[model samples]
Target chain A: MTTQANTDGIVYQLRDLSVNLRRRGQDRQILQSLNFEVRKRECLSIVGPSGTGKTTLLRALAGLIPVEGEITFQGQKLEGPAGDAVLVFQDYGNALLRWRTVKKNVALGIEGRIPREESRLRVDEALEIVGLQKYQDSYPWELSGGMQQRVQIARALAMKPQVLLFDEPFGSLDAMTREGLQDELLRVRSLHEATCVFITHDIDEAVYLGDRLMLLSGSPASLTYELDIPLTGTRSQISTKESAEFLRLRHQVYEQMRKAHGAAPTTE
Target chain B: MTTRTPISLTKSGIRGNRRHHDGKGVAPMIGLLPIAILLVIWQFLGNPHSVFFPLPSHWWTAIQGVEQQGNLWSSILATSLTFIESIIVAALIGTSLGIALGSIRWGGKALDPLLDFLRNLPAAALVPAAAIVLGTNTKMALVIVVLSSIWPILLNTRAEIQNLSPVLSSSIINLRLSGWHRLSVMIGSALPGILLGIRVAAPLALIVTLLAEFITNLSGVGALILSAQQNFNSAEVYALLVVAGLLALAVNSLVSAIEASVLRRHGPST
Candidate 1:
């Protein structure tokens, strides 16, 4: 079957995409019929309760896992990891190469593919983007949780990817650090001009960072809610979060998440 | 997050050597006090005529005499060469075998029984068998040492590979690192474990090397000790034993220093 031509702004087009995985010697369905379009250059925030197969969905989108039904990327069938896509993991400690310095880790994906000079330049640029130029020589283990996460992000950014798939990238950080990184991500995303699929369970984070939001919930998780974030212009953590529109969107997402998680939604 | 904690906080504090660095190198100096006291006591009180326990000055004289005879340096070199060669061979074989078996889902299981039996066989017990089979040559001694010392490296590497974080594996895939790059990353991640294995195997390798030499009557320090005993030269025998002890101490210190220097980049293991 042929997919639509790549003339449209859509980067990822999914149709009845289902994923059945082998878990503990049993074939379990993790994602069921997830149909959506990830728009070009848009931050698509996917929020869901814990254990709702949000990571599984992100894996399917990254083409890192097998999925039933159609999932097309830029009018082509998505198979193994795409050349222009990179992932930033939440467990930054494990995701980074502890043996390597921050600069070397950032250069990992792009090095040996490009010329040595270009690779070095790209690593320097990525570190600058993450505000980690000073820490380029330090190992990841020597950094704090927030800085380590930035290293992971810097590693991804150095690839100059078309799609940045983040799996709860700031979920482990403290609230203040998470907010700071969220702003930094917005700036980096704009500078790099890459589409992002950010997975998170935080309602406020989903609303604050997303250009658009999609929720995956229930046992065999599927897209249960979708909305365009109305708050526009430059986003600061304090002002944007305190704004009325941000509060409204955050509340709507929380209510939908409560229903999706099988918790009774209160009228109040 | 901007301020870094003291490096000692990251390392095990129970070790006197580590505390030595933070405590102005005083702990290790203090640690040598008991040995110094014992040596002083022995030097002052021990009889020079005792066959079993000769004076410290006599041991020095005996060792000097052996050195003058030209047997001391060559014997030490031979033993050191064998020990070094066996460790290198064992590390290569062990790491390769470990990565191969650990990568495959069923490889380790298939060889479980054989590995268990081989690893349990005493290194000393295998010395005579190896001497008979390989005719007591350097190659035979190498095989015996490697057979005993390889278990730690192989086992540690395998466990590390098996326990490699899934996030790192997925990151490797997502980054689309080429085959060579992937292997480099894999080896880099497993290096700490491999180094740990080498640290454990160093002492075992030394013991097996000495045993192989002693049992096979090969030309090394072990042979010198054996010959000194046979000739009823108690002073030379005691001197050679002290030399052997010094070798042990040196190997341990060297290996630990190397391990620490390398692991400094990799961070303290967990």
Candidate 2:
């Protein structure tokens, strides 16, 4: 076992997972015979270069993608788009049910058709977790990108799913807003302690948010390497991005992505 | 809960603030300018003594004469009742038929040619046929109005439903929203288009009513126009034309107002 999977409570085990995707006129095998296991309540970020199928692999986990793979959750054979593993797409605005109020949209993720009172309580609780209880009645279009993302998070959180999958959930936001949202997400994850798989092309975001980093190759992408981030103090957004270990991981992921892309890392 | 409420309020507040700042009031008034100008020009051009058609004042004189004779309101009442009856029945039939047509693609396709042919039939030509079937009575008037007005509403709604966004359907299906829940959320979302179809048909309703009245010789504005023209009361003819124009304007405005309210209620979420 890798030292990473050596931790407690294995939440998911993906066995020899392979995914092939076709876009436009070309068919490519993106995830080629990959094996990974996520432990209970651990936050893992999958980072890779653009066109490296980071999002595609995340979708595979969410069961949104049709792949040749076996994903088991709590030792149960998974079905397609497993409701237990909910996905939050990066386009928060589009992710939400625009017609529904924020409260109702959050309420949408609640499992099963339940009593009104129970759904209401769950909805309120989820909104509170995302710090968005105030905007419950407003529509998604009204909310800013960060707030919309919070609504998305709130909705996913409401589902009370075993796994939370984010496909670059903050990729569409501005730098400052994305940073704030990253911190907000981290705080929410810390509080809820849900198993998370976040995929992003951003090296810094992967370093900042992940417990373990996953790098991927370019075209017909495959997992390149994995690294663990060590932290010793209270991590805040601004400070952590500038932290030494964070920078090291960030640099390493950057170099790996460049190498996978067959290019030298540009001095930016 | 409390925190999210603040965000909602803040968002609406920001939107409200932006709208107030961006208020360029001239555009709306520009729309009204044409009507005001046209009314003025029309009123003058309709002068009987003048070279242009006949003064609107002359039209007013004829209107006053009809009011003097005191059959104006009664005849209008007679026509209005038939108009109302035809519209309610047509709305029900058209909306229901549209739903059925929208639900069945092949059926709609098969009927498309027939519906197109029917829609193209000139009201003037249909008058004699309807008159023969229903006789020269108010019922005949009703039939004419229904035939003329139903097609626009039925066709538009069917097209709207057929062209509904597929994204919404999949989303609802994914969520397992079936039966009543699915219809309410999914079909209800497309209400803007349905409401728009109704709004577009509103003008057709009035036009058909008038045309039907003219066809059946029923006592209405259409009959009034024919009578005036027959008696060579050009002033009365112009007056009847003006009243018809006003009625058409009122109906159109009412539909527009209704459409606006519906759009506001449905919002941009559709």
Candidate 3:
């Protein structure tokens, strides 16, 4: 286990992090003893089965919920929701301010923190990054689902936070749109060089975007497996997925997921 | 492989249908055809000498009679003044209190019973009490109107605030929006609900204002109608009733116009 006292390049350090939720007047443990370190400028993907508390872990790291164990960000204990991190939700319809235009929605995150002129420039930059410059004046509902998710990303990007937390942001999109956004997220992440914690249920997405992939399973879930992709150079949707090494790593993770779920092997 | 239809295609189709329906400029006038025909028939069948009902032609004479008495414009001015003042005061007080009660859990629970009792008390029943306390003045009339009409605005605003989406709240927290910025966003988002409440309350306020005038017998359209009835001036009584109906129509249209514009500007996409 890594020491929580190490601040160096780590954006987040968790030691035995646990979270309990109160449901129907009963205490239910959702996350149990999570130990991990999210390094700077790296995309960490957490993949799990549906309802396995992947979002709960992300929320805990973002300091949006209470944790029973130690979690520190840049050497300081995370007490609550900090200003240096921003979360992008899965539901773009509910996340983006419908009453505001694309520019205004992006400006929402920074308008209170900076002067008017600077906020406008930051909003434009964020919109430019997401390729939404042309639709800056359009309302969120006027845009397509993919575009609306991009606007959400722009809103978070405009904040220029050191850490970005995405909670299955592409889950609600169609397959083609989801693939398109996955690549866009990769480009934007590289451009900003910000640390990212992307949560998803899709194994392919987890392996594609993550610098390191972590699998979480079971009730009161904890980290079950961690793997590093050995494929070198820039990752491509077609070439990288077809490579033998990528296939091997993907198969290994799938087998581990089946094992974690206590399912019988498919072969006789 | 199944080819999925793009979502935008269906969305645009729905919008096109709405636009096609709204493009018929003469539809509203067509809807009023029955009323127009009814008025024409009444003009021909009404008896001029009838004490209970008068012909539409007697409207001019009744107008002259009220003008001759020098009470026509003054009565209108008094009623309009009370209605306008009461609505403004009610909107301000109701919105602030409603937001506070809705956003703060403890505040809402503490005031629930009191607000429930106040909401149930009929506005007409307060006229006598207000008149007794305030001595039948414009202040008493204003009080009666506001007390009766404030419930809709307060309740609607509170419900909207309480139902504010969790995503929006989380965004506010993640952005670290200050108190003023948060309030501005909240008020802007809740404008549609607040305006909806005001739309319902406006006509109710007007009715209550007139009721208060009729009960107090002070100086307004309601008082004029009451005096004309007592003196057996059938034409003037009927004329005042027509004017009251027109006033109600005007107030309703004005509120509807404002509600439409606000919803267009600040409401969620249809």
TM-score of each: 0.90, 0.74, 0.90
Top DockQ: which candidate number?
Answer: 1
DockQ score for candidate 3: 0.55
iRMSD for every model: 0.8, 3.5, 1.8
lDDT of 1 by residue, A125-209 (tens): 9999999999999999889999999999999999888789999999889888998999999999879999999998887888889
Sorted on lDDT, highest at the top, how do the candidates line up? 1, 3, 2
Clashes of each: 0, 14, 0
Greater-lDDT candidate between 2 and 3? 3
Cα lDDT of model 1 by residue, B181-238, tens digit? 9988888888767776787789899888888888888989998998888888888987
Computed on C-alphas against the true complex, the DockQ of each candidate is: 0.81, 0.16, 0.55
Candidate RMSDs in order: 5.2, 8.1, 6.4
lDDT of 3 by residue, A1-268 (tens): 2324557789898999999998899999999998999998889989998899998888888787888998988778889986688999998887787788899999998886789999999999999999999999998878899999999999999989889999999998998899899999989987998899999998888888888899998899999999986678878899888989788888988899898988733311
Candidate 2 structure quality by residue, lDDT tens digits, A1-268: 2223443488777888888888797877888877888877878888776677787787777666678878776666556656677777776654566667899888775535888888899899888988888889888877787998899888878777777888888887898898888888888887787899988877777778888878777566777888888865767886887788788877787778777777754322
Poorest 10 consecutive residues by lDDT, candidate 2 chain A = A1-10
Deviation from native of the Cα of residue B204 in model 1, angstroms: 0.9
Per-residue alpha-carbon lDDT of model 2 for B188-221, expressed as tens digits? 5545545555655667777878887776667888
Q: Candidate 3 falls in which docking quality class?
A: medium
Compared with the true structure, the alpha-carbon lDDT of candidate 3 equals 0.82
